[model samples]
Target chain A: MHKHLLLGVEAIGQGAIDGGMSGVYAYPGTPSTEITEYIQENELAIERQLHSKWSANEKTAYETALGMSYAGKRTMACMKHVGLNVAADAFINSAITGVNGGFVLTVADDPSMHSSQNEQDSRYYGQFAMIPVLEPSNQQEAYDMAREGFALSEETGVPVMLRITTRLAHSRAGVEYKPVLDENQLSMPQDPRQFVLLPAIARRRYKSLLDKQASFVKLSEASKYNQYTDAADKSMGIVCCGISYNYLMENYPDEACPYPVLKISQYPLPEKQLKKMEAECDSILVLEEGYPLVEEQLKGYFAGGTPIKGRLDGTLPRDGELNPDLVAKALGKETYVGIQVPSVVANRPPALCQGCGHQDAYEAMNEVLADYGKGRVFSDIGCYTLGALPPYETINSCVDMGASITMAKGAADAGLIPAVAVIGDSTFAHSGITGLLDAVNEKSNITVVISDNESVSMTGGQDSSAYGKIESICEGLGVDPAHIHVIVPLKKNHAELVKLFREELEYEGVSVIIPRRECIQRASRRKRNISRHANH
Target chain B: MKSNIILAGVGGQGILSIAAALGTAALENNLYLKQAETHGMSQRGGAVVSHMRISDKPIASDLIQMGTADLILSVEPMESLRYLPFLSAKGYLVTNTTPFVNIPNYPEYEKVMEEIHKLPRFIAIDADRIAKEAGNARASNMVMLGAASPFIDIDFAKLEDGIREVFARKGEQIVEINLKAIRAGRQFSEENK
Candidate 1:
């Protein structure tokens, strides 16, 4: 079985380099940025140097993969599901401080917001951090749940996640390779304050993570990737979860499904194959890919019993992502529609790239905010959030990931004196320097800009913990090195970037500007990697 | 015996290197593939596609459902009418009559070639003037994967050993200029379809 193909995030970066992951904290984001860029271009993870770099974001890639699972070994953090909401406070307190070596995390959701903003369902943050979550119905169960999600997070010690989506993290298939283990060494954690939580040791490590949630629901009721099967039309049993079980066997291409499927790629909801397919069929449906986290936990909150369908009883899409002709029109079948997008087809969308220094810093910040009125700019997440479309609608807030300097410092503390914030140069080094040090400790009346472009050009060019350190991180966050300027977002540096955005939008207090350059697709991929290393 | 394709263009139109040489000729035809692709923020230049498939067995939804694409291929020209609802009314678009026109109400090219001549299984070549007469005008997506190699079912020497193993690490004159741009896109789709 020497298959290869890969890409469910490079089969969890080759199942964390053949399962004994030595390191890989992440931050590039898209579909969990190619699982740390396929273990930073693996050649046995760069001859075992491992620790794939690029963090400064998802909470410093989940506290540096929980400090390399607290000095024991095995790692893996990954992101994209709003980079697990900036690594949800050390991912829900690293599940009440558990692990010593094996920690996995992973994430990747983006159900319908293709390149994400929300269709979030990191299995309800893996059941609100109660843990054990896996979810991989394809790419060989995303390479055997990332090669046994670190021995299921070290025989149920904690931190496991895995999740996946955005069509099982940007598809492709095959996979194969398995047996390769060996990396644990440095061992420790035998309770010396297991991981000092400090609230009386996090209430005894949160009741041993609630007494290991009944051994993670009896290892998801004997999971061999949670199956069940049994087909003979017991009305509707189905259930799915994770690549929505490959859009339900792509509507059963002779995998012959009358009913009774279960599937649920490992999760605590396996309660004995979800109570034998909710007592053998007669009406269940489910199919989760993003929300309706197991049909809102089997419709718990009254007015429901077995008649449970998915995306909150709308039978199917109460939102997005899910294909096989929307599961063959929600299984009633009858697909085949096709032709008719033609009125000479139109709407293409995603622009900013004809030599894009964010299109000369959004055409000099839309001609210096055409007399600053229509909601002063805001923007954040990379590719300069396509300058909020149109021939530069000049960003009136593209929202999350360093919400453009604390939403332009809460509209410049409500007074809105020329409120700006543009962002990106690795989202102002992810989370934009704590909203520019809370607008330079309240010298507010903002301007900011920082478009930099040095890299992380929207999840591809990568490297940019705000390159060449955004003018000494805006002069060490205090901002007034003569109101920190810098220019070069060229179309011949658009009149010195419109005189540094009209003298940093008529600075009253905190002003930045920046603009800089580099990402013209990361300067032609660093001139095609320095001419393919000067032709070897 | 299945293909499903889609591919399309725009986002740095390399169409994921024609889906990594049709996923390495569907893994040397041991078959069963999937594909999908379209990384981050609509891949900044946007309007991407991918989908792909291949089969002989075991394949389940890496998308490619709505109307069941049997091949769209694209590389531009209204990104092949935006995946005409995933083709298959006995599909086969192919595309690339040049025209990426990076947005700006870009519609009429004789009304997008009169809506790809109302597709009765289209072709529409140009492919950057046959990959600049096959000398490698960036191997025009391997000349639109060689004008979509006689509508894919694999083996045109396993797509030149899948572009000689995905351009054998950018050497050998870039795999002989992407196998002479997929043989000038399979001799202009065998003398124009």
Candidate 2:
């Protein structure tokens, strides 16, 4: 077998292509964006003409995957954990509606808030939707899970969720290729009313979903990824969930753990193994990467009789990620502490690129907003979110992807006249458009600044769905054509941008100010490519 | 045999290129490897570290445990100290003497150098100047990789092959230049040690 060193996300992309995925839908988000990106550039996927276009948003991406599944083809939708909130409606209902072909939803959770606002776990979504969830312990498992998850989804007539955290998603390991599977022939759902969720039909479908829970548990019990190793020491049974298993093993470098161990990569708590451990061991320790999902479940169902230990019992930190040293301490092993960093080392936080358009725009916005009180600008997620930091601390609030527009409108409605909303172009296309629509519908006295870099700059400059369509999108949404102003965001355009922002802030109705420039990083990359081409 | 390294630098410093070359070398040696990398906002200009592990046997954690890494290979001076906590007591530190002064609070050069001098085992080289001397300042990452290669357990020939494999797509000229850069680096470290 040939081995290729692949990142967790790249392995999933390869797996989906090899497993006969018809399409991969996604909006670029960290630790998850590379899946679709990989597929888009894969030779086999390109030859097969898989549907690998960037979706407008996660909601649209989820719906598109569902539609492809409805047409009897394997499909995968990918997004970051918070992006799931946008697709939660479609995700939850899909479980009830079931599937015709096969579907897998890959949600990458950023534990410790690496590049994200929150460290929310996506496995909870799997349980909430009453579907099978697979968490890979390593990169190879990430590949295998995505490859096999479709068949598992079809078996239960439900969508499968492949959950990964930042560590697993961004980590790289050698993965062996599996035999390629053929795509399902084009067909429709066997039952005409399968996806039609009327009240009466929905009740029966909901019952069907509830009925599948037992099988999911059974599948988890038999899952090859979830293994139980017995040891003579019954003093403590360790339950290492997902990548936590790696941390656990790292603690015992020389040999296996003395205590019996349960490594769970498949969900539903692996009932049979848990029961086996509960009966055999005196106590159980739950080691998981994200929130204490497994520990909390064991505590609740086992009724505290087992003396379970984890984040709740102070065995692990309640928040952030788990490392080998922390896992060693949990296993009652002496942790290795290294040399302390020298006092001369200073803290280096992530900042906007030196010559970024966001910097120029922020400088101008700060200049204009200085006249008004602080906290007037509400920003959305993107590279511009960095404006909340450093020399130009321009943005005030950053709640979600598209909260800036709505929050600004809400504040304007509360008589905080001339509130400003700063949003990135890709984000504006994702969910900011609707908020802009809401503002325009009511003619809210808010100024919406669409920071257009013509790419999703924060997530490494992926093609923005809102590219070349922003001004038209604003006009189409019924914003007055005269109020929509587009300006180049550059040092030379500083005075013009300041003047525009001031004028828009004073407007009585919704106004959009688009500061347009290609991302500096991307521009440089493009320049390098062009020069290389010319030289060649 | 195992080689664990904490590769550190400021974002956009081409550390990933060093990682790419190292991963290629590891694979060439048929060793099991796991490398955890930083992505997203950090690449815009933040402190970043990649935990690169290669072993003859199967590896467990993607992250190297604290005080277990055999080497802390950094492309920036201050970044070398950032992961000192992950370096084993007997491990060596190979770093570029050049400073990447993106942050406002960056420490004085003498202070940073004083900390480096305190390390019992280290090789400090001006990889940018070396790479420029070898004709391609962009190949500075390659030079640093060469400077650290003697510490890594992998074969030097395999590392050369790794660089060739990585830069082959760019053409023979690029490959030749990088090879020259790496050899210059290795020679410097050998003499300095």
Instruction: Give all candidates' CA lDDT scores.
Output: 0.82, 0.93
Q: Report the error of model 1 at residue A70, Å.
A: 28
Supply the DockQ value of model 1.
0.31
> Which residue pairs in model 1 clash with each other?
none
lDDT of 1 by residue, A227-271 (tens): 888988887888787777777788878757778787878888867
Candidate 2 residues A128-162, lDDT tens each? 99999999999899999999999998998999999
Worst 10 residues of 2 chain A by lDDT: A329-338
| Candidates' chain B TM-scores in the order shown | 0.35, 0.99
> Best TM-score goes to which candidate?
2
User: What DockQ does every candidate get?
Assistant: 0.31, 0.87
Worst window of 10 by summed lDDT in candidate 1 chain A: A296-305
- Candidate 1 has a TM-score of 0.37
